[model samples]
Target: MDIIQDLEKRGLIQQTTDEEGLKNHLRNNQVTLYCGFDPTADSLHIGHLVPLIMLKRFQKAGHKPIALVGGGTGMIGDPSGRSTERSLNTTEVVKGYSEALRRQFNKILEVEENENSVVVRNNYEWLGQMTVIDFLRDAGKHFGINYMLAKESVSARIENGISFTEFSYMILQSLDFMKLYEEEDCTLQIGGSDQWGNITAGMELIRRSRENQDEDIKVYGLTVPLITKADGTKFGKTAGGAIWLDPEKTTPYEFYQFWINTDDRDVIKFIKYFTFLDENEIAELEEEVEKRPENRTAQKRLAEEMTKMVHDEQALEQAQKISRALFSGSLKQLSGSDIGQGFKDVPTYETAKEEIGLVDLLVNAKISSSKRQAREDIKNGAIYINGEREQEINYTIGADDRIEDRFTIIRRGKKKYFLIDFQ
Candidate 1:
């Protein structure tokens, strides 16, 4: 199937300027397409995956994909989806975020030395150098006040308030399209649903700039649907916070868990939106989801593919090991690193690495309320040390109880877990 058909099959295409024309444009030529990612944060989150993956889909179809990091426009901030004004980042901060995004795109997208390999660009390279007079005369002349105001991005914020800086963001983004079209022969721009106005505005600028020259401009825009959960809640978020792509921000294990715990109602849609699995494979997974929801086969596959794609095979294996160890309550098989990743959010206490009575340790770690309660928990066989029932009230926790001689796993009842860090 063609790229368009594949995207359609996956339910990825939300809005396209000219569906037929774009299908033909992609079919006939080695099209150069671009997607812009603003550096609003140091790391791109799971929400950014759809566009990033879309870029890969284009590249795989023998097209050049430009991953544009918004260094210039990021300073002004796009007002497309926000109800309030964005606090502008300093030059140094935007530049740092831009570089960070570039590095992340390099890892996520397939960057190579080949002709159709992904190319990374920063709008700051051009927008940063263009003088205000030149920008107003060349680009700003095409967009009338009414035209700018009519766009949903600006219109939605007019009631609440919109600043001139953000109001002019679309023009700056249009400059990016025009610049890329003139210099790189880029003919397509893709983004999330929120960017439709900006993308089309760029196309308009490209056409208007070449109107007097009598050149046929074929720029187009495409947007992926906004991901929504079956439940009323938002996607890519949990009680903790946003699910970041960076391992340091969200560990590989945590990332894996996020997908593994995909709601039954949203799992199938998520697999289609995120994974590159073929229709047949996806259909089979759908069957698995229907036949054996208890197995969570679909969720596991989604987590594996996502983990390996964002991280690596080794990271995926580690995440799986941690998951299994946690599920089975088999802490003995887990290494220190595995324990660290698996129990990262669990409560922890630190103390000297000396032998101590289990009851005293439980009280000190706050795992038990008092000596009496600690004794009761131990006597009732509700306390477990390193996944083993420790019914001995006088049991001493020492080197034998510590994992890697640095940490101990303490379990109260069935699920409450605590980490004891040895100094």
Candidate 2:
């Protein structure tokens, strides 16, 4: 299969250096490539998926993928695609974050004990050893002030105050490219469109480093397009913050729902960018989306594929079960974890198991404003506890009411849900 052609068709390739040469390189042999991911957060988010999936794409195409963790460069945050300066993380914190990111990527990009397996690398090995003097003498000298200002990353940050540390990020990334080129023979670098400046800067370093020796050596850079929602807002953002890959930060159910709720306008594009399905499968989904938009078959498939890849079959089943139970108002079969994910966003209150009298609990838990309202709600049969209608004002919550003796699901009126923790 022509992977580059498929990527182009999916609208993934935004910018490239020597497209014809890159296509030739991938077609002819197993090309070694790398994409640098800065460890700015403890967990990888949906925004990080584009380049990560790009690495997986190349790996699937029988190319070598080196996921470069920015353990060293992460100390000095990259100013690309940021409106303000990032708070500097301590060396210890960066180390922790880098390890976490490596773990997450290791799961996504399968690294088998084979010749054509994905590899993980950290820039700290070399960058941590280099002195400020060596860095300035080696990489800083090659970068001209005019040339740096010409790059979009630096220019955009010039208006806003950008620190010297962040300003030197391009040099660090360039050094990464050079280091990988020397050690792993990685000739290509890929990233999001925002990384174009740093990417080309890396190519320039490679070219300058080999100026006298084998100047004909070809190093390329490719970038995926910036993802945007069909509504013209930013992707990976919601009422909650970013959709994190870590199940703790963002539950598997939430992650699956993010994709399952994709707008029809964006599903086909996402199916292409995110899924590994062949053309025929995607074509079939496209037809389903066109024919029956309400069925949400495309969205469900996208959710299933992504959830299974990120989490596992067990986690996917849990997410699916939570979704189904919530939709049908059938909460009896759900497990504690499932209920936790479903009611994570709902209002929560804590009370002793014995103290949870339905009427008093509603008022005290703020589900109802007053005792009168609580009584009226119960009399009107508008209260449901654990998916069962409750009209008795004297109803008392017990161990039986708790899902796994931890949580009690309380439905106020029809749609608003509340969660009560029974200690």
Candidate 3:
């Protein structure tokens, strides 16, 4: 199947300027397409994965893909999906964010020297150099006030009021599309559903700039659908916060858990939207979901594919080990690193590396209300040390209880866990 058909099967295509023309464009030539990512944060979250993955899909189809980092526009910010004007970042901050995003894109898209390898470009290279007079005369002249106001991005913000800086962002983005088309021979731009107005504006600028030429301009735009959950809540979010792509922001283990906890109602659609699994494989997974929901086979496979893709094989293996150890309550075999990732969010207490009575240690660590409570808890077998039942209130927690001589696992009651850090 063609790239468009594959995207269609995944329910990825939300809007396209000219579907037939784009299909022919891909069929006849190795189309060079581009997708822009704004550096609103230091790291791109799971929210940005659809477009990044779409770029990969194009590259796999023998088409050249360009990952455009919005170094220039990011300083100004886009008003497409916001009710309030964005606070502009300083030049240095935007540059830092731009560089960070460039590195991430390289890793995810696999930058290499080849005919259709992903090319990373920063828009600041051109937009930063263009003077205001030149920008107004060249790109801004094509975009009339009425045309700009009619766009949903601009119209929706009129009631709430938008700054001139953000109001002019569409023109800046159009300049990117025009510049890429003139320099890189790029004929397609793709983004999420919110970017449709901006994408088409770029196409308009390209056509209007070359209106006198007796040639048909073939610039086109496509957008992926906004991901929604079956339960009416947002996707890629939990009570903690947004699911970041950077392992430091959200560890591989945490990332794996996020996918593994995919709601049963949304699991199948998520598998299609996120994973590159073939139709046959996906169909089989669907069968597994229907026949054996208790096994959670589909959820596990989704987590594995996503973890390995974003992190690596080792990271996936570590995440799986942590998951198994947590599920089975057999954490004694876990290394210090495994325990760190698995129990990252649990309560922790740091103390000197010395042997202490179990009741006293519990009271000092605030695990128990007082020495009497600690003794009662130990006597009732409600406290466990290193995953083993420790009912002896006088038991000494020493070198033997520490994992790697750095950390100790303390469990109180059924699921309440605490970490003891030995300094």
Candidate 4:
């Protein structure tokens, strides 16, 4: 199936303008479409995944994609998905973030040496050069005040209060599309459903500016559904924080674990949304899920593909190794690197290189929260060292217990485990 049809079947399309005409245009020619991502943060989160996945899908189906980093728009935050005004990021910060985001995009999309190798563009090139007078006359004149006020991004925020800077966001974004249309001949702008107003504004700007021109342009807009969870909460976030693409912000092991722990209800939906596995293969996996949910084949595939895409093969392997070791009572094999990379977030405590006993270390690491409780748990056969049950309250772990002369794994009960790193 074509990319558009496949996306529709997967329920990716939330809205589109000129659907029939756009499909007709797509049928005749491989269209060039663009999506903009603002660098609101240093790393893109899983919330940004839908548009990106769709971009790759289009690229795979023989259409070109332009990945626009909103280096310019990052200065003017979009109010579409927010209830309050955004704090402006410094120009230097935005520049650094934009560069990092583009570099990360390289991992997700095959954007080189292919028929539809993606093009990366920054809006600051054009937006920064335009004078206020020229911008108002050329681009601003095409938009009406009432129309801008009517937009949900603006209208919904008026009661709570919206900033003038955010109010002009679409005008700047529309200018981006107009510039791309004039310079790159881009005919389609695609984004999340929240972007419909801004996208149509671009189409209107193009039509208003090029009226009665020799080459008539027909720009299109398509939007994908915003991700949500089965329980009606947001996707890609938890009590810990937003799951980040950067391993430093969120470890590869944690990222892989997030996907691996997807609820059974959400796994099939995520497979349809995130993975490129074809319908038949997904169906086969779903059938296997019926027989053996414990195997979690579908969830594992999701974790492997996404982790490998975001990080790399070595990182994914390490993450899997950590996972297996953690789950299968093989903590003895955890090397120092694994302790550092895998248990970076797991609660840890330090001990003097000479005087660390197992029970004392357990209490320090918050395994039992108190020395008395630690002793009780240890005596009751609930405490473990390197995945082996330890009942002795006075079991002092010297340098011999260290994984690589630096760390020891301590377990409380069946599920909770802590890493003790010795200086």
Candidate 3, which segments miss by more than 4 Å at Cα? none
Ranking by TM-score: 1, 3, 2, 4
- How close is every model to the real structure, measured as TM-score? 0.99, 0.97, 0.98, 0.96
Tens-digit lDDT track for model 3 on 395-423?
99999999999899999999999999999
Residue pairs with clashing backbones, model 3 = none
Candidate 4 colliding pairs: none
C-alpha positional error of residue 392 in candidate 2 after TM-score superposition, expressed in Å: 2.3
Worst window of 10 by summed lDDT in candidate 3: 324-333
Top lDDT model? 1
lDDT of 4 by residue, 139-255 (tens): 888889999999887898999998888999989999988988988889999999899999999999999898878766789999988877888877998778899998889889999
Model 1 alpha-carbon drift over 4 Å, by segment: none
List of clashing residue pairs for candidate 2: none
lDDT of 1 at 28: 99
lDDT of 3: 0.93
Candidate 3 lDDT for residue 105: 93
Q: State the lDDT at 328 in candidate 2.
A: 84
lDDT of candidate 2 over 1-423, digit per residue (tens): 598998988888999999999999889988999999999999899988988998998888889999999999999899998889989889999999999999998999877988779899999999999998999998899999899988999999899888888889999999999999989989999999999999999999989877889557889999999898889988999999899999999999999999999999999999889888888999999999999999999999999999998999999999999999988888878888788897789999987767467889999899999999999999998999888899998988787888888888889878999999877
Query: Of 3 and 4, which scores higher on TM-score?
Result: 3
